[model samples]
Target: MSFNGNESSAISLAVATEMTSDYRTNNPNETKAHFFGKNKLMDILNQNGCVGIRAYYGIDADGNKQLVFVGADADEKDLYSGVILDMSAPCPSNCDNTSPLNG
Candidate 1:
């Protein structure tokens, strides 16, 4: 999908990847043992009016686990507010930290 400057979808994917990568690198064991399902990611996308979503796990240059979430909106002008959570801090059992639309 074509993303304008700082598109929400692109930004959310980037944030997810960065958070996962950091978590994996710092906690490799956790990455292999604990699997964060795509349900949360999909919820975020769906709540934001995304018609489609794609998620993946990978390692970053720093050997960190990366979780990427990509989504597409049919309406070009459609704007989404909140769709992601901040990974900078520890998330509760519910995985609720911060809003993805924030940054």
Candidate 2:
């Protein structure tokens, strides 16, 4: 199996909302979402040999939830030496209240 950077990762709004709602119900104090800037995301995607990306669940020194992103190669291996990204603006601090996914 190989990646050509053509994977379908879409989900219906209803499903997304339900999942987020469940998460909030369980972890009411946790971050509702994480916002990674487009430029940083594009940088990871544009790295040489990067066919996709993988997000790892993380916790910062402050014990806040975060995500660590790294480029993935065609074989689904992490490009550890490439441009890894973090420092997302997490929700509760930066969120769109109007978005259904945030509720």
Candidate 3:
């Protein structure tokens, strides 16, 4: 959980959050009722070589969790995005958008 630095993990998390937002935005009715995980994005994050960045456990959209990340490069500015991950349950590597997985 050592964010707030030029760590790749932090940046990757922020990117994943942004991607999730985009996914939801493009498909509202399909995504609003369910939360999802982007496996490839997560794979990138996991390769960041950092300890597990604790994922807050609870209903994904049950509350507000701010996702603020310091760029891995100092020249890059901070990234702020809102995300709602369904950490409440687990899904396989490829969670399809066709069927809303009730995780």
Candidate 4:
């Protein structure tokens, strides 16, 4: 689901209710997330300390083809944060990274 500027007021109220603060009051130019499709493969990777996924168009500082991230575990400190997004059409069935682990 998505909302435009027209629903800004309603979105503010809902965000305040759940997230405790709406971006309108503090920063009028606060960016909103564009999409929220569930990524099932995020589970297996997270057990290794990965943090999240951000699917925006742009480039890394090194100028690599940097879409579909798999990162977020910090340096030297071993933590299993988890993966957040895998932007494939469909991960293979044979892959052990299945759902229900975090469902």
Candidate with best lDDT: 2
Q: What is the lDDT of candidate 1?
A: 0.48
Q: Which scores higher on TM-score, 2 or 3?
A: 2
Per-prediction TM-score: 0.31, 0.93, 0.22, 0.25
Question: Whole-model Cα lDDT per candidate?
Answer: 0.48, 0.91, 0.38, 0.36
Those runs of model 3 whose alpha carbons end farther than 4 Å from true positions after fitting are 1-11, 32-103
How many residue pairs clash in all the candidates, one count each? 5, 0, 0, 5
Error of 1 at 70 (Å): 4.0
| Tens-digit lDDT string for candidate 3 (27-59) | 654423323346633532443333223333333
Location of the lowest summed lDDT over 10 successive residues in candidate 4: 94-103
Q: What are the runs in model 4 whose C-alpha is more than 4 Å off?
A: 1-21, 34-36, 40-103
Superior by TM-score: candidate 2 or candidate 4: 2
True lDDT of residue 33, candidate 1:
24
**Residue-wise C-alpha lDDT for candidate 2, range 1-103, written one tens digit per residue:** 8878886688999999999999999999889889998999999999989988899999999999899999999888899998988889989889999998887
> Number of clashes in model 3?
0
